[model samples]
Target: MASRRTTRRLAADAGLLVVAAAFVLPLAWVILSALDPHANLRVKTPDGLTLDNFDAILTPEITFTPLLNSLILCGGATLLTVVCAALAAYPLSRFRSRFNRPFLLTILFATSLPITAIMVPVYALFVQVDLIDTMQGTIFFFAASQLPFAIWLMKNFMDGVPKELEEAAWTDGASAFQSLLRIVLPLMGPGVSVVTVFSFVMMWGNFFVPFMLLLTPDQMPASVSINDFFGNRGMVAYGQLAAFSIVYSTPVILLYVLIARRLGGGFALGGAVKG
Candidate 1:
């Protein structure tokens, strides 16, 4: 039995390694393509590997304007989503209402709804308001779209927390908001981090909304800008496209790694302080 269990564990580990490789292969290809010297506007790969693609993206040949726009939009969307989630979660978690069950269910239902169903009305409204080519408008759209899931995730996490902490804080002369800021927010680190990561990734990766709403090419997100690497022109751009994609995805990869590393450390620290 012991030997069988060990064999099963080894098999599981091998299976996971295969899955990880499958997920990583595309990224590896992108990195390799970016380094290929033949990557360019024409139909032929450059003779050897070079950093020219990175140079073109970072320095002159290709402008960083789209990257800058993406950063601003993503930042705004994250702030909006987090704040809205925090506020909504507080009420939903604490309040007992005859309507609470239905309300929570509705939020879950809304989250499952696809964005495509609402795009037509959303687009028409944006047109009426003259917000067709702006970062603020894009941020607003992203925030609204992300709100339901953020609220649900936060509320579910908060619901598991005990009410006694808040009562004690109140008895000690702390206001409701103060108790929330001091007692509740500290315990909500994991959930908040998860929601923030999801919101940032979604807003950063979104291409359809940016493409439809941003009339000016200057306001395009990096996700949309990547389309320029390919056109009626040819195949040589594939190498450059690969390189650009690798660069674009690097920040997201780093963000995920940083979050994962901090998650356990954060919980440990919080536990120590509480003890």
Candidate 2:
């Protein structure tokens, strides 16, 4: 029995390694292609490694402008989503009104609605308001779209923060808003971090929204700008595209590395409840 269990454990580990490699192999190919000067659709070891692919693509007009545009749009949208979600979540989490349940259900339903379904109306409204090709308008739409899911997550996180802490704060003459700022929010850091990262990632990877809304090339984000690497009539710069992708993806990778562990370390609600 002992020997059989040992064999099964080894088999499981081997199976897991295969699963891991399946995902890692593609990422490995992209990195290798980025370094290969003559990289094509087929990824292979560099015939002669060179930084020229990166150099050719890195320019203020082509790369930096779109990169900066992405950062601004994503950053602004994330900030808006996190703040609004937190405030909205706090009430939903703490209040016990009959309307709260139905309201939250509505939000959950909204989360499943595809953005494409609403784009026609959204674009028409943008036209009426003269917001076409505008960064602020894009950012606003991004935040608004992400708000339903962010609020749902925030509310669950806020719920994990015990009401006992707020009760103590109330005893000390602290207002509800004051308690939220000092006690509740501080304890829900992991939750907020998750929401912030999620919002940022969604906006950063978005292509269709910016592609449709932004008419001026100068206003395009990196997600939309990368399309230029695919030229008209059967031409594509694979090496340059790979290199640009690496640059485009670094911020999100760094952000996940920084906060990923905390994202799983949700509030120890039991301790707060006991306190």
Candidate 3:
């Protein structure tokens, strides 16, 4: 029995190492290739490190404008999604109704539907409305695409807060909105962070949505503009591509760092709920 257990443990550890390597190797290639001026598809050490790759792609046309567009699009969408999700979730969390379960189930169903399945109709609608190349239009769609899952997550987190606290606030003449803003939301900081980060990251990395909606080159976000690295006939600038990728990833990293504390902090509701 002891021998069998040892063998199983060893096998599990080996499998995990293999899985880790699969992810780590690609990331390693990206980092190393970014430093190599003449990078290729193969992962190997360069003759010497150089910053030429970074220098080449740091121009306003290649990096600055698209990055600014991404920040505007993803940032606006994330803020909108979080606010809408909070408002939509509050009633579902605090009220009792037979419709809530069905509504939530519908939201869950919506989340499972792939973006590609509806893109055809969405594109046609955008064209009809003359919003095909607009930034605000893209932000609206981005928020809508992420809203379903955001509501689901927000509702689950909001449920964790005790109703007694809201009742006390009600007795003090606070409105539903006030109670939500001052009490429930403060207690559910981790959930908001999760939703904000999830929404922003999803929008930031999304290539297809913005690609289909925005036609103007000047309006394209970093997600769509990164395709410029690939040239005709399967040619690609691997070094510059890797450098752009690292720069493109900076905002999301910074967002996570900013919210790290709130995301890790669980609801401190024990004392408030005890009495």
Candidate 4:
């Protein structure tokens, strides 16, 4: 029995290491390749490390413009998704109704549907409405695509907050919206952070949505513009591409850092409600 347990533990540890390497190796390649002046698809040490890769792609046309567009597009969509999710989730969390379950189930169903499945109709609708290449149009689509899962996450998190605090606020002449803004939302900080980060990251990494919606080169976000790294002759600037990838990932990493405290801090409702 002791020998069997040891074997199982060793097997589990080996399996985990393999999985970890699968993810870590690609990241290693990206960082290594970014520094290698003559970077290629193979992962290997370069003769000399240089910043030429970074310098080449730092121009306004390549890096700054698309990054700015991504910030605008993803940032706007994330804000909209969080606000709408909060509003939609509050009622489902606080109220008792038969319809809530069905509605939530519908949202869950919506989340499972692939974006590709509906892109044809969505593209046609955008063309019909003369919003095919507009920033606002893309922002709206980004918000809608993320809203379903955002609401599900928000509602689950909101459920953890106690209702007694809201009742106390109500006695003090606070409206439903006021109680939500001042009491419930403040208490569910972690939930809001999760939803915000999830929505922004999803929209930021998305290549297909913005690609299909926005046609104008000037309006393309970093997610879409990154495709330019691949030349017409199947030649890719691997070094520059790796550099851009690292820069592309910085905002999401910074967002997580900013909200790290809130995400780890569980609801401190210990003394708020007394029997």
Candidate 5:
């Protein structure tokens, strides 16, 4: 019995180690390949490293514009999504309406709809409105697409806030908007952060929407423009592409680090009552 238990424990540990290595090895390879000046596909320890890979891909036209466009599109969409989701959620969470159940079910259904299913009509509508290739136009769709799920998520977070907090705010002559803004939102910092991160990451990595919507290469986001590095003539610059991948990924990493600190704990409302 003792021998069997020990064997099982060793097997579990070995399985976990294999899984960890599987994920880490690819990332390690990418980092090493990006630093390799020779543009080799296989990651190898460098005898003498060079910054040529970084220098090659650091040009403004290829990398900078796309990155900036990604920031603008993703950042704008996240702001709108978080704000609208919060406002929409407050009523849904607070009110007892017969329509609420069906409405939420509809939103859940919407979340499962693939972009391909809507792409034809969506592009046609964008064309009709003269919104094709426009940043604002692309962002509007981004914000709108993420809202259904964002509202669902925000409602869950908002439900955790006590109505007593809003009641106290109301007794002090506060309006519904004031109660939501001052009392409810602060406590929901984690949820807002989660939504922000979710929306940003989605837009940042999205390739299909921007590709179908935007015509000009200059206005394209990083997700769409990364394809440029892979030449159409069967010439792919591996080192520069790897370096560009690292650079393109920086903003999301920074955002996660900055906002992730607030997600750890819920607000302590233990001493709300006054003697």
Candidate 6:
């Protein structure tokens, strides 16, 4: 029995290491490709290595407009999603309404629904509203898409928090809204941070919606900018494209690393112990 258990543990660890490598290897390749001047993304041969690609993209002529566009869209969308989800989740978490479970289930269903399924309708609606190419419109669209999942995650985190904290605040003449603002929201920090990060990443990296809706070249997101770098009609500007990708992706990676530490324990259930 002991031998079997040891074998299983070894196998699990080995499997996890393999999985980790699988994920890391692609990112490593991206970094290498970005540095390799002779690396043609269109035609991948094994031997090319150089930093000219990074230098070319970082040069002032390359411009940082795409990076700025991504920041605006992601920042606006993330803020909107977190605020809306927090407002929505608080009531659902505290109330014992007959519709509460059904409402949450509906949100779960929405989260699972593929964005492709609604693309046509949403695009048409945006066109009708003359919002197809605007940053504000895109931000709202991204916020709405992320809200269901954010609310669900936050509600679950809030559920694990004790109701008595809010109740005690209420006894002190705090309004329901006040109790949520002063008591509950402060405690839901971790889960909210996770969802905010998720929403920001999604909006930042999204390509399809921006590709289809944003007609103007100037309004394009970084994903679209990268696609354009490769050129239309299958032309590959390998060096510039490689550089642009690295420049755009670096800030995203750095931001995640910075935010991850702050979000660590605040939202977890173990952090919910009475203070």
Compare the candidates by TM-score and give the number of the best one.
2
Model 5 misplaced regions, further than 4 Å: 1-6, 232-234, 254-275
Q: Candidate 6 on 78-105: residue-level lDDT in tens?
A: 9999999989998898988999989988
Per-residue lDDT tens digits for candidate 2, residues 1-275, read 99999999999999999999888987987798899988877657888889988898898977899999999999999999999999999989998999899999999888878997788888889999999899999989999999998898889889999999899999999998999999999998887887788789878998888887788988889999888887542578788889999999998888766665554532432322222
Residue pairs in clash, model 2 = none
lDDT by residue for model 5 (69-142), tens: 99899899889999999999998988799989999899878876786679778899999999988989999999
Per-model CA lDDT versus the true structure: 0.78, 0.86, 0.88, 0.88, 0.82, 0.77
Q: Write the per-residue lDDT of candidate 4 for residues 17-40, one digit (tens) a residue.
A: 999988788889999999999999
Clashing pairs in 5: none
Clashing pairs in 4: none
What TM-score does model 1 achieve against the real structure?
A: 0.84
Q: Each candidate's TM vs. the true structure?
A: 0.84, 0.89, 0.88, 0.88, 0.89, 0.81
Q: For model 1, how does the per-residue alpha-carbon lDDT over 1-275 read when each residue is reduced to its tens digit?
A: 99999999999999999999888766566766778776544334347878887776674224477778888999899999999899888978998888788988888888889997777787899999988788899899999899988888888778878999899988999987887788887888877887788779878888888878787877778888778766533654767677778777878877767666776543533342222
**For candidate 6, which ten residues in a row score worst on lDDT?**
266-275
Clashes of each: 2, 0, 0, 0, 0, 3
RMSD value for candidate 3:
5.0
